[model samples]
Target: MNDIVDLFVIGGGVNGTGIARDAAGRGLGVTLAELGDLAQATSSASSKLIHGGLRYLEFYEFRLVRESLQEREKLLAAMPHIAWPMRFVLPHHSGLRPDWMLRSGLFLYDRLGGRGLPGTKRINLRSHPAGALLKPSFRTGFEYSDAWVDDARLVVLNARDAEMRGATILTRAKVVSTTRHAAHWDVEVERDGRIHTHRARKLVNAAGPWAGKLSETTGDPHRLRLVRGSHIVLPRLPGHDQPYILQGGDGRIVFVIPYEDDFTLVGTTEAEHHGSASEAVCSPEEKAYLVDFVNDYFAHPISTDDIVWTYSGVRPLIESEGSARSASRDYQLAYDDDGAPLLTVLGGKLTTFRKLAESALERLGYGGQWTARAPLPGGTFDRRQGVAMIGRWMEAHPFLTEAWARRLLRSYGTEAETILGNAATAEDLGQDFGATLSEAEVRFLMRHEYARTAEDVVWRRTKLGLRLDAGQVAALDAFMAEARGEAAAAE
Candidate 1:
């Protein structure tokens, strides 16, 4: 391991990876260490929508809205395969809010974002197909723009880009201690039961929910509010590819987004969490609450039995004086009095990760004004025109299965060809799992995406765990164990 680095970032969530990518692009020597798999925390458990936070307008968060809006469009074009556009239908319950007010909100959302995604459109609930699943009491609604992101993939792609730009990304590596040595920080990274130390001119605590704890390690007095957000997945809603944003009776917004091909994701409950971020679990109460909220707004209600999976994430909110929901989602960047130059990132949303990272790098005095036009990994291709590249890759590998080819194209874009190389058939990709997962793809992820553990491979690199059975996971685990042994012997 390199003992000298320009910047050391704690946390492997969206913010940390984004900062690493941005800083690396600006020619800074960077290293990012994560105690667990990337996105194992809040990054993967997001509502998975990238928008301007239209609801934020009511709170008068104009700056957040505008920044998020711009970032949304930039990220959509930057990583089209893992992220794409989706329209959201806001169904108005006549018994609740009026259509004009909803229309006004949509108007603000449309204009606030100069995003190319089409503006708001009024819809007749009785005539629109989206209305068929809604309660009869809802007769009017509006459809507007937003984007759905494969949240985990976003982190992995960013990490990959940073590595390509010469940043060292170490997953399953914990930063257990740090000491200030005059103008720099001596950071300790623990991996494989060994402690590796490095010196960084600047350190960033972008550990999301763990930011507060990381600050304590450096002996900073700042504390953060760890709020838990939970989500539930249910059997797919018929023809529910587009997402729906509904206003809960409690005046909060709950998202019912189309999930994997056969599931609908509904979430999230916000409550003060006083637990470990890595061990956060979705409580039965949260699942029930989400199911009830969705059922109240829809004709086809989902119950506990309908649930497929549930996940919970801790939002490291900057402690303030109000309800956790009202607690500001605005991020804070700090340089404590220690002079060791630690930048602690607090309170950020998935939509603004790229911008949040850019700001973090600027604060560290590394980039100053560079990387405004930088692209993420595989982002060199015009993402909006990704289909053409997919066509070319498919044409080149005619013997490959469509499902397998599409999986690579959508997840890695044109970079999939690099993995495919001269392979001409399924045999070229090696052993196949029940899903499109293959030995070739797994090796590529392990070599390029910092996938060191089964969780990283199964959960982050691919969502195959949701589709694979327990037995399949066991097999993958055994395979990983053997691979780890071989890797250790080689070293």
Candidate 2:
């Protein structure tokens, strides 16, 4: 901890981890410290789309949209397991923007970034399968290609890849203080009731919502506007697999997408958040807003009673002269080299994390942008081989149900084989905590993925929390606790 490293990153969200991975791959000695678990905040609370920010076109953020669209293709190719192409159906509403406007936007979107996926096309609501559950007034819709991602897992995988390339990832570690020296930084980190000081040539303040507060310690005079975005999950709407992009009357848009296998994920509302970012939650008002937003289009209206789960995250946007909904989604990297170098990341979305990382390093006087081609851990195979990989898993282990096999392939990719090992039967994989969550898989996550608690395993590492009942979750908690105790005793 006393040795000076090349970089010290203060955050474990998408941007922080992406920077660590990219820097480590370029032969920089990097260390990343997270106040809590990885993706414990805004990074995990995204709408889970890797699109080019189609709505931003109206805001005239062409540069951000173009970079994001380009990054979307690279990210999907890099992590085929956790990210994939998803088509979004935007229903035409006569009361809102005109059809020609929508067409023009989609046309620009299709050509803005390099074409890795299918382009936009018009569809008849009465004939398209995605429109079956919609209200009768919608006669036309536009379908465009974007990508879906396991947001939380994406953060964890970046941390994993960073560690694989020689970056030190510290979780449950909080930076209590930082002192700038002539040539290096002295960062005091508190973990496990002990304080450790690490010296680094440069520091990166990538803390999402907390970045503004952290910047105050260094006298960085940048202000951030905290915007809270919330989402709600419900039982899957019984019709199609494609997601919907609903245009709200407030000039904002919401997404209702298929989540996990049995639920629908609808989001999100932009409200000015006051107070602590960690305290942000899906308020009753926000929940009502979302339920009403979707009810406007769905033929079978849904009430708040249908909601199964809710989550919210606070976004730290650079102070702008507009409403929260109109604030920019693009990022700004401010590098201050007064004493020791400090790069503060402000206002970024999930789709552009990789690009943000490359830019961050270049600002720090480092080069070699190699993350675009490097695959994340277990994502070494081509994206087209995903189905073949699943088939191989099922063929190798007949005990695995088709659903279970597909889940494993999607979650871990090539690493799924390592978890299976030589187990010929489901019983060999150890205790089944229901919903196909096996003890072997749980241990693998704890051993390799830095999973410390059942919440980390179920909620962040995987969305199996939606399937596991309270009792099953309790059992998982007890098991993980006992396992940790045994590990400590062994040490």
Candidate 3:
């Protein structure tokens, strides 16, 4: 009776952490348990855009697109370091949708979000800088605005903010089972090979692709259409900062986004995933599909050999009768209060996570909406100050390379000072695990960001995996293992 939490959230993806942060900020006692590291699942595996799903306009999902557009702007203003605007170039394809239809869609997209972002405009691809990489066949294209985000970092920042607001965030923890009592629910969590029980006034299941399986514990027929979306990272395409929205002839759209400064991210194929969501991966066919799709638009064709890294994530869309490509990206909140309140999030997009959280809390009867204006951790600075902040950091730490300083600032924002601490030189930052990744940053992640393993650091917390060799990865793994051992011995 004494150890009761007001809200217990399962899953550490954007939705779960977003809900926990919102609830905790509103003075509700919250506990969030993640089966693995934060964002280790579908959250980090996203295409890394805080976009409005412009293509959804074709599917007549006006509400979803409009809300996502609004959320995109809100997130950019709140966390400029991790989320910023990027223009998408949609080349004209005479064989597919007509140019007029494309223009009409862009027009609706521009007007739908209340004109906060740059309006969509036609571009002469033959003359623009973006044209240089594209084929001559793309004589004309339209450019529209959308925001890009560090998806994994978004999850971590939300979880961190929630903790600061007094929510207990447990990584490497799983809710083994739940039992509804008369007025509350008993949640059994397995952490570090030990089981602990806690009571909660309400329980939230934001388990992404695993929502269906987790809902089985409640004896509900929670069906989800598991769709696998995969991405491939390649060496930077020689061109502008703008990304591309490639329309495949097969009625699917693919995105070629600029990623991590030196890479271009190309992705997202829609295929029904049948097995465990955890086992989802970019199949060879998916890779070929993406490569072929992108090759259609770019003058320089990309093959599977050009791919630097590939990742796949399962999307748990609400089950409906349609092809995977036509499935709705809109989210659904199912509430059951026959006993204690139980909220299960069915499907959602990364861009509208905050909105989704607000809805979830409202459904749970938590009072007031408080997250709309609040900035995420280290995100209190004005959006215009992102570049200035980096410059200031570089000026203060003259020992850091411009590239290194920028990377740190972009990743940690104002908190970069905390990570850099009093280090006077690169050597003071501790062992270099290659690609500018040092023990200092690794320790910062481990201590503050719930990074527990080398893969967590390289793959999720940072994209240094794209640059580090296998030997360097092994070195990092050994270093982290030793560091954990030392921490354990000290304890």
Candidate 4:
């Protein structure tokens, strides 16, 4: 925190980390400060889809869709472990738009990225295996492509890659204030009750929902619209593998995607978020609404008791007059001049952070002057490389359980082995913190993933929160308390 950095970034969500990664890859001396654990805010609470916001097609966001579509494949190729493909099946309903209209949209979805993925196909719901979980009334459906992303890990990976490129990342360090001088910006960050100041030639506010608030810290009163989206995790349906997209009686579309190895994720009510982002949570009414919607169409019924977990996020949409669902997910970036420059990002989705970062940098005057083949840490594996690496690693470590190995592969790609490093046996994994969590893995996350607390591990670094027991959760918190103290002691 001594040397003046070329770029100082606020927020550790996907946007800030992504911009840091890109800037560092371009050889910029960058430093990023996160007030809380990385992605603990809105980033980790997302529905975790890296799609082109298929429903946005209704609002004629073709340009945004096209860019997101292009990013889908690029992201999948970059981090197959954390970002991969999933197909969403939309069942045709009598009241909704016709099949022909859906088909046309699917066709566009196919071509949006110039064939980054296969085109959509019509599904004979009754005949296809995917339809077995649906009610008898549903006979036809449309299947389209999209990628599922590990939102929090995506942010961590970007931060990791940035660190590898010499960007200093400080987690649990909140930016208390930003003051602009004639030539540079002075940032004061508070960590463990201690205040530390850093100087940067340029500052970027990539604070996700808090972007506007951070702008105020720099004395720029930018406006932002906060739209809340909530998702519920329920017991998985029997034989549910592929994801399903259901149209509500209302115009909104809901996703019932296969989640962790044991559960299913259904959700998302988009409401105008009119209050603090810190208080965002799935409301009682939204829970009932989602359950009712799912039971209406699915063969299996779900009740509130079946919901194991729930999360909500405030999407910082560019304010518009229409309903929250109709609001644009497209991002807005602005910078001020007067010698010291500050860049701000308004709205962004999990899928489009990379593209968003590129655009923000361009506006910050890095356009055309630089280019990068930058990949997130552990993302050196292209799709083909990832599989080969996973197979080879598993083969060499035959003692490792297939389930454990597979989970690690999907979570960390080739870097999974790096996390498992020299462990010779399952017992070497240390105390079983429940689920597949081991003391080794927990320590690895603390060392590599920028995790500061149990929430950082269970909620963000891993989705084990959905599986850990109450006692296990307590134990993890105990360990986290010690690790956090250790982290502070180091400084």
Q: Give lDDT per model, in order.
A: 0.82, 0.93, 0.90, 0.84
Q: Give the TM-score of candidate 3.
A: 0.98
Relative to the true structure, candidate 2 reaches a TM of: 0.99
Model 1 segments beyond 4 Å from truth? 368-373, 399-401
Superposed by TM-score, candidate 4 places the C-alpha of residue 467 at a distance from the truth, in angstroms, of 1.7
- RMSD to native for every prediction? 1.8, 1.0, 1.2, 1.8
Residue pair clashes in candidate 3? none
lDDT tens per residue, model 1, 240-278: 867889887676789998776767889889988987887
Clashes of each: 0, 0, 0, 0
Cα lDDT tens digits, model 2, 1-491, are 67899999999999999999999999999999999999999999999999899989999999999999999989988998899899899999999999999999999999997778999999999989988989999999899999999999999999999999999999999999999998999999999899999999999999999998999996675789999999999999898588999998899999999999889999999999997999999999999999999989999999999999999999989899988888999999999999899999999999999999999999999988899957888889988888888788888898888889889878999999989999899999999998999999999999889899999999999999999999999999999999999998999
Question: Any residue pairs clashing in model 2, and if so which?
Answer: none
Instruction: Say which candidate scores most in TM-score.
Output: 2
Clashing pairs in 4: none
